[model samples]
Target: MAPATISTPRYLLDQAKRKLTPTPNTIPGMGAVDKRLQEKEWDQFVFAEPPAGSDLKPIMGDSGVPIIGHMIEIFRRGPDYILERYRREGPVYYAESPALSSVLALGPDATQAVFSNRNKDYSQRAWDPVIGPFFEGGLMLLDFEEHMFHRRIMQEAFTRTRLAGYVPHVDSVATKVLANDWVANDPRFLFFPSIKELTLDIASEVFMGHPAGTDKELVTTVNHAFTTTTRAGNAIVRKPVPPLKWWRGIQARKTLENYFLSRIDEKRRSESTDMFSVLCHSADEDGQTFTDAQIVSHMIFLMMAAHDTSTSTMTTMAYHLAANPEWQDRLREESERIGDGPLDIDSLDKLENYDLVINESLRMMTPLPFNFRQAIRDTDLLGYFIPAGTNVVTWPSINHRLPELWTDPEKFDPERFAEPRSEHKKHRYAFAPFGGGAHKCIGMVFGQLEIKTVMHRLLRQYRLELPRPGYQPRYDYGGMPVPIDGMPIVLRPLR
Candidate 1:
């Protein structure tokens, strides 16, 4: 499975190159762009026109080895290597992908510019050509007016009343899933696979109103399709060349879509309280309801978004809790305080300690380390000109570790987030586990409730410990992070 080639048309590349080479022209806000006088500032903007005769340091250490750079190290090493290089080589760093050029940006100012104010300049279109087969017409890939319009319809699924309604569903689903027949004494039982299954079940029951035992095959198909599509998106060549991963991904997506479309007619006819039903009955301001195709596409998108992200966060929290007994003890104590009452929305609010632990886990091991946005126009970012069509990545993994914002940044300290300390308050985007701005994750509240509920039940019944001391989970770089060897833990029943 070769890495996916990210291609930019020659005309677009040429346009970006032109924008990079700024000329001495009078611009309103930026004053006159004097080429000779502002050469230093100009050099910051242009990668091709670096200060004459200066050697470009490798964007990532030893990642230049064939296939290893794109295929392996980037995912395996996580964000530390990139952040280390950024610190050594200044804010904006460049790397070659064999397919296309990539630029990685770090620091609070750069992150804010990319994610907050200048998001319009970036396109999720690059992701579209690959992910489109699976998540077609999803809000993450939509742009401009279409994005906003669809977002409004999707927003209806996450209202306060709707979220409150989901609390019990989350509680019940978590309770049932964690109470599976798996042995409590076994340390080799993989938490990632278990949690993945649990989240998919949760999505089926909570989001789609499917009964606990129903839709097993459909859920399995969707999960396989999502995993395959994400892998295909990262492939260097995506043709259905026999036996290749991309071919399998394409087949998986087709199968999943067929299943979803098949169910849409039935779902549309039977009015219900699920989010899927809401989406089916939902109409835009123009009285437009999603077509069958749109319905299937959006349903797949919602399920993938809901399941994978929550699973990742929960897995990370589990790993951290297993590693730090003190934190686990604190969480258990907090869960005890909340008692064994139903973990409804009101009960979730009382588990403030659970919130801190989850927030801290997200900050330490962010599910999506970097967000990609393509520049739409020539934009000045803190004096650096980011040309249109340039790929701009805001590394949240790096920002989460910034020393200026966090005390003992590398340590797992949930207390730092508690009151009186209030460290994360220093920067609004400091803890962007759910992201920020209008594009923030819509299911964030639901995700938190799900984690707290699951944790509350699990902690009350069992004392979880890792297989070995100082065990760190390895991530599968294909899509969202997953435990490479399955996070092994022993769940000792509380006596």
Candidate 2:
């Protein structure tokens, strides 16, 4: 079969060229390339056909009968279904739905090769059809040099000094959001929505430099857009008909673009110190910067990353802490040691127990279970030959739960991360909550600081427990692993 033709939007092509030119003070060993071949290669490689006899795996049930794998079932059953397949069929496996040509990788070495060593080979295009309209020039969709260049420009927004400056902003947002009366003593309060609200507030204050609780409309619009786009990407039917999720996603993208563009001029004129301002004033080696559209698209991507991933991480941590009260007590005791005060950069760093809790939560409930990469060229992974056009996946969710790497693989134990054990050191990619290598999450430190700060304040102010005994969090296997129902918790004032 002939490969699918994907035309680059004129604006994205222009932005790519702008990033190619060298800028002042380009790092000595940056290894910058000023060419379009990489991007061209990506377009060709993503849509190429897989070799004959590369049969996709079938869904197996308890009785061992082959069942049709649907997106709905995958979203509902999540890692369980995939893990079951891995147990039955070795390391590499495949699954197919009408919409996706899916691949699943099950061990540390396999995951490392896909996410770390061979990331350049994968295409973000699978996510692009939905996210591209909203985040046209965002780094996630760009490959190789194009990805590096934009990442360099955005790195200015996350400097240590800038992150330190965000401390008060994060603290203030957490205090205001967690102090709500609705959260008090309510055992059935849905956590996903609540945490989503909190993260949106944090993003406004810390990323955009807006005041907490403001920009509600813009936040709602972008959040809806992200949800709709993600759903469309995983939808089994790929029709362009109106009223479908894909249609709604496209409309949402336009709404976000318009909203972001309207705010750019005001933000630029004020010369604000937030990420939006940094992107506006940032220049490459040639003193070039993103145009208006690029700025809006980038903001959309940054806002989604900042809000959704942080909120999901916080929710997962809450689930595990609520499930095990003894651990919660330990964390609260640690918080008491640090005192019940607003966390600054220095104080946030001191919460070692909280850090372990967060790490364990991430291991069990990885926000992105599998990282996908297309092979840029033919490559070898653990003696298996992977052709240039094939899709490669790294399963962090599966690897994190391996019996060989973790003791009591399914239990909620934070001490495994403490000194002397440090079991995650078994392999380089054994604990990649934020991935590894060149495309490792640049905001990893910032994300960790944000979650730790929130958990510290919550522990000091409230005693939380799960609504019902033996509550198990269900997974949504769409993009990130989100709790199917909002994680419910009852909060009691600590005082």
Top candidate on TM-score is 1
Error of 1 at 327 (Å): 1.9
Could you estimate the TM-score for every candidate? 0.85, 0.83
Error of 1 at 334 (Å): 2.0
The clash count of every prediction, one per candidate, is 9, 8
Q: Could you tell me which residue pairs clash in candidate 2?
A: 22-285, 23-285, 23-286, 24-285, 121-374, 121-376, 122-373, 122-374
lDDT values, one for every candidate: 0.70, 0.69
lDDT of 1 at 284: 77
In candidate 1, what residue range of length 10 has the lowest lDDT sum?
11-20
Give model 2 RMSD, 1 decimal.
13.0
- Per-residue CA lDDT of model 2 for 342-390, tens digit only, reads 6778888888988898889889888877666655565555555455544
Native-to-model Cα distance after best TM-score fit, residue 336 in candidate 1, in Å: 1.9
Clashing pairs in 1: 3-235, 3-236, 4-234, 4-235, 4-236, 5-236, 121-376, 122-374, 123-374
lDDT of 2 at 290: 79
